[model samples]
Target: MNRQPEPRQAIALKYDGKQAPTLTAKGDDELAEAILKLAREYEVPIYENAELVKVLARMELGDSIPQELYRTLAQIIAFAWQLKGKFPEGFDPDAGPVERDITPPK
Candidate 1:
């Protein structure tokens, strides 16, 4: 029987107003490179500022895409599609649960 490939989710890499637009990549460096290559092929300006890029590059799957960056990218992509944006649906970047200590009080 033939099976359908799992849907790949896109992570938006938002930035501050002073920075450029970007997209988040999986942890694998090569995978990230490939994603960046595609973005470049489309003539999209991928921001490469040191300080900002450094922080974004380190974002892991479990971490919530920071609010500032989230808003920035959301707006850009929203506009890029002329407000008929196609954000990765059902991809809740902040859906993870919070952790807490359960040690007994002294």
Candidate 2:
């Protein structure tokens, strides 16, 4: 019997209010390409943080994304969506229920 090797999963780049991260091209080929492409498509400005990209390259699929990392990615997605990018269309910034007075305005 022959054993198949595990497939490499693409890393999901995250961003923060301090910096925007993205790839150059599409697909899961290379980390840089994917980030640049997504940035361009979404009109999000990428930051000059090489270390971030390096960390992303080291991330493996099925791994739990770090809390800070997740927060950063969420910020980027929100920015893109707000800018009317095709990446996150129709995504509400506040998709959860909000506590507010439902009384009619008098």
Candidate 3:
């Protein structure tokens, strides 16, 4: 039997240089489309990770991400920084962003 795909989901996070990332917005379906449209309009970088979105979408608006997600979220931010060619001094360009681990080892 065929199964329908899950509705699209989007989560937006903002991180200032000194603070942890905070969830700015999130939604599924039509709202997801609107979030993406606004991001596009503002030239925000988009990264696709359904599993990450699933977890992030659970957070309340304006909540900072928990410590456990720091490494993964850092990778995402590093990717955006790379795209803009604005890495901090001594940052290694040859070492690409960390791989996202959907499941952590026990």
The number of the candidate with the highest TM-score is 3
Model 1: per-residue Cα lDDT over 1-106, one tens digit each: 9997533322335434343444445433556577667877876555444445556656764454555665445544545543333334554436664343422234
Instruction: Work out candidate 2's RMSD over C-alphas.
Output: 13.3
Show the lowest summed lDDT stretch of 10 residues, model 2: 20-29
Q: Candidate 3 has what TM-score?
A: 0.80
User: Which of candidates 1 and 2 reaches a greater lDDT?
Assistant: 1
Arrange candidates by lDDT, descending: 3, 1, 2
- In model 2, how large is the Cα lDDT of residue 73? 57
lDDT tens per residue, model 3, 9-103 = 99999988567899999999999999999999998999999998999999999999988998788778877987888786876779976455544
| Highest lDDT scorer | 3
Residue 93, candidate 1: Cα error in Å is 31
Q: After superposition, which runs of candidate 1 have C-alpha atoms over 4 Å from their true positions? A: 1-23, 26-32, 68-106
Model 3 whole-model lDDT (C-alpha atoms): 0.87
